[model samples]
Target: MKKLPHKFQIPLTVAIMLPIMLTAMPAVMLYSTLPKGAALFEPWLDTVTRMVPFALPTLLVIAGSIRFVVTKWLVQPAPSL
Candidate 1:
């Protein structure tokens, strides 16, 4: 299979992370907050819709910041021979 170009990395990351984060986080939140057998699908859908606009930008910014910090300060330099 052909690999995607490097330019596609960020967009691909967002595409993959978006659904996983959106589904998992809201499900967990609703599961804890709603009553048992209190009808989850509608509320989970509602929460996901409400979260969509904010989620992408937030994910990008946070991921970029962490990547920057890790590369800048957290990673160790190779030891000299």
Candidate 2:
């Protein structure tokens, strides 16, 4: 696939990453918190519901911050020699 511009990459990454992380985090957390052999569907649904509102903004901020940090600190300057 063709690559995206840096300006387009941040939002694209956030969009792709947020759903996977959001789902996986809550699933793992709920699994650990819930008793063994207990029902997971209801709890997972509830957790996802509660988490969605907060997760979106948090993920966006995180994605933006990472982009900024990587661009500023990691992307090396061209060699002078």
Candidate 3:
């Protein structure tokens, strides 16, 4: 498969990543708001936030590779013009 332009990849990655972060955010915040006696993973939550979006880039690469490989083996290539 031909490489997709950044214009497409950027948005594509975001579409895959946003839901993951949204789901994790509340869990993190609720943990932080827990009772004082509870372990405060304040620093860890901060770190997780920064590290969170990173999964998108990796996801894009892996998904693209899988599609490309599957198309090569299982998909019939388009006939040349």
Candidate 4:
């Protein structure tokens, strides 16, 4: 398979990882906090369905802002010998 350009790397990574993290984190949290043997499947499915639309854009904005800040303000100068 052909590799994508360097510029696509971060965005592609975020796209792939964010959904997995979002879904998995919620499942872990809900399972731990909810009563044992409580119905899990329906609530998890509903939460994921309702949460994705709002969470995706909000997280994208946050990720973009953090990327901008790190690139803009976190650059290091060449060290002198």
How would you order the candidates by TM-score, starting with the best?
Answer: 4, 1, 2, 3
Question: What pairs collide in candidate 4?
Answer: none
> Across residues 18-75, which tens digit of lDDT does each residue of candidate 3 receive?
7777557756776777776775566556657766687668877997998889888989
TM-scores of the candidates are 0.63, 0.62, 0.41, 0.70
Error in Å for residue 60 of model 3: 1.2
Ranked candidates, highest lDDT first: 1, 4, 2, 3
Q: What is residue 58's positional error in candidate 1, in angstroms?
A: 0.9
Each model's backbone clash number: 0, 0, 0, 0
Give the Å shift of residue 12 in candidate 4.
1.6
Off by over 4 Å in 4: 76-81
Q: Report the C-alpha lDDT of model 4 over 1-81, residue by residue, as the tens digit.
A: 998888798889878998798789779878998998898888888888888899978987998999789878997655689
Question: Which digits, one per residue and each the tens of the lDDT, describe model 1 over residues 15-40?
Answer: 89879988889999999999877999
Backbone clash pairs for candidate 3 read none
lDDT of 2 by residue, 10-69 (tens): 568767887898888889988999999999889998999999998778866986898689
Worst 10 residues of 2 by lDDT: 5-14
Using lDDT, give the best candidate's number.
Answer: 1
Total colliding residue pairs, candidate 4: 0
Off by over 4 Å in 3: 1-18, 25-47, 77-81
